[model samples]
Target: MVEPNFSSGRAAERPDAAVGSAPLAEPAAGAAIDPSKEPEGRKETKHLSRSRLIWRRYWRSAGGKIGLVGLAVILLLALIGPSLALWDYWVVDDNAFLSMPSGDHWFGTNQGGFDVFAMTVEGLRKSLVIGFAVAAIVEILAALIGASAAYFGKKVGMVLQWITDLLLVVPSFLIIAIISQHTAGSKSSTWLLIILLAAFSWMISARVIRAMTLSLVNLDYVTAAKFMSVPSLVVIVKHVIPNVASYLIIDFTLGVVGAIMSETTLSFFGFGVQKPETSLGTLLGDGMASATTSPWIFLFPAGVLVVLLLCVNFVGDALRDAIDPSSKSGGAA
Candidate 1:
């Protein structure tokens, strides 16, 4: 007991030394640390998702803002304007044939005695449907064929390339004109035109997608998926297409403009959306002769078409800038 009292006296003498000592010099190498148990003074960093980043960039663009707002207004007009119109698009107002804008005929009448207001809205609706439908079909076809070609190179890629080249050289406009003229007699000419437009339009987009896929096919995830025995279709769908989706989105927006222009051009030449069911093209064609005499007919539809195309172009440009890493057109993210 006396010896133990000496040891306790020595320990009591070093009490201040223990209190003065530094904490452990370092954590053991590779020691596990729970992030949740981190000190209160430390702060964790957060990251934005890819979609949010792209959206932020898009919203920052002046063109994107204008395009979004304009497109919404146009869509609203197309949907709700018909309900508020004084006269139906197809109804014959013999008494007010080609009349000027008035309380009764707000946007006036065409030679067919149809309301300009009603016809404009209806045409806008049809153009939107055709434009969107064609763009969707083109993108689907381009994605599948292009991704497949690139992933399964060799004979398949060569054949696809050949076909694409052939289509490029072929007179798509003339062929479309011929087919559309023949189909004009049918009630589904508008739908057929969409198919025709999609068929030719996809070749260019497909080639671009194929080029993109070639670059992506050998990437780490793609190679790993192959090593893991993933189905080729699944690999293409899950990996390749998503990588190229940004380009596809840009192409799709531009495709809408192309499709609309194609429809309008065909209709102008008397090969598109036939009688009974009108479109912006048909309105423009009808108004061209009386452009000076009845400026309202030509001016209203033309203005709408111009505005629609401008908005689409704006959105497309913004999307391209936002998605491209090298593009400085989109201001700081």
Candidate 2:
């Protein structure tokens, strides 16, 4: 079994150090003694009490509170808004669409006569689903690529890294557009779009992770694990990932938020989700056309989209900060 490498203050004393003519002798049981075992005579420090540490650390900063509140609001909206979206996303109902904001219609209506609020809620669901799927795929792909490169460095790793670098220079939108157009808008196209985006996006993350893994691989603890004959995969999974998980989580959130926004932008520009099937992007696009005459169409959908994106970014930042040792200040009392 692996043991923690954390240093304890205590250390064994050396016999060579003598005081005056008499040598130091071991103390009797229950007598006062030095905390450290080493000749340095350092005392061992006690771990902080959990409750005391928690109390000491509670008031970190104002930003954390704001982040928490924003996260909660987004979560509540995600859950409640979708649950209350009863009507068909595409269905045109006069009362539902183009109606002014009131108790009956919280977000007012759209040109197609569909409830803007319901459609927005439904759109959020779709956006979130796509975002999560894209992020997960990207993170997994990146982690694997990074691990492969770092663990087995050679021509293969160099070539792969080079390819990733090359891809990074290209405009992502153009490539995705070309691919989407070639597929002819089938159901497969959407999934393919997601996969392609994720594949391309993973390169940067993989490179970052590779750098981190490379540094960690040389550490004594990691070398010891290797010496212990642990399987490479297990070691990577258990030791490597846990150490870098904070970066991965933050990277994933950033990727997902970007993917969702990119999807929305593409759809808005008519290179994305086709007519009839609506996403937040589609709603925003339609809203823009008649926006001058009926600003509600644009305002409601765009507002929600902005809020959703901002919320995601905020939460992502919070998590990153919370996990980062530098940002964390107080220990829990």
lDDT per residue (tens digit) for residues 64-105 in model 2: 456557757766776788567655566677655467776766
The TM-score values for the models, in the order shown, are: 0.85, 0.74
lDDT score for candidate 1 against the true structure:
0.90
What candidate 2 gets wrong by more than 4 Å, as runs, is: 1-59, 94-97, 182-189, 224-231, 328-333
Highest-TM-score candidate: 1
Off by over 4 Å in 1: 1-45
Quality of model 2 by C-alpha lDDT:
0.73
lDDT of each: 0.90, 0.73
TM-score result, candidate 1: 0.85
Report the poorest 10 consecutive residues by lDDT, candidate 2: 6-15
Candidate 1, residue 183: how far the Cα is off, in Å: 2.2
* Residue-wise C-alpha lDDT for candidate 1, range 1-333, written one tens digit per residue: 445455444446566546445543456899998888789778576688888889988998999999989999999998898899988888989899889999999889988788999999999999999999999999999999999999997899999999988998999899998888777657788888888889998998999999989989989999999999999999999999999899999999999999999999888778888887789999999999999999999999999999999999999999999998789987776
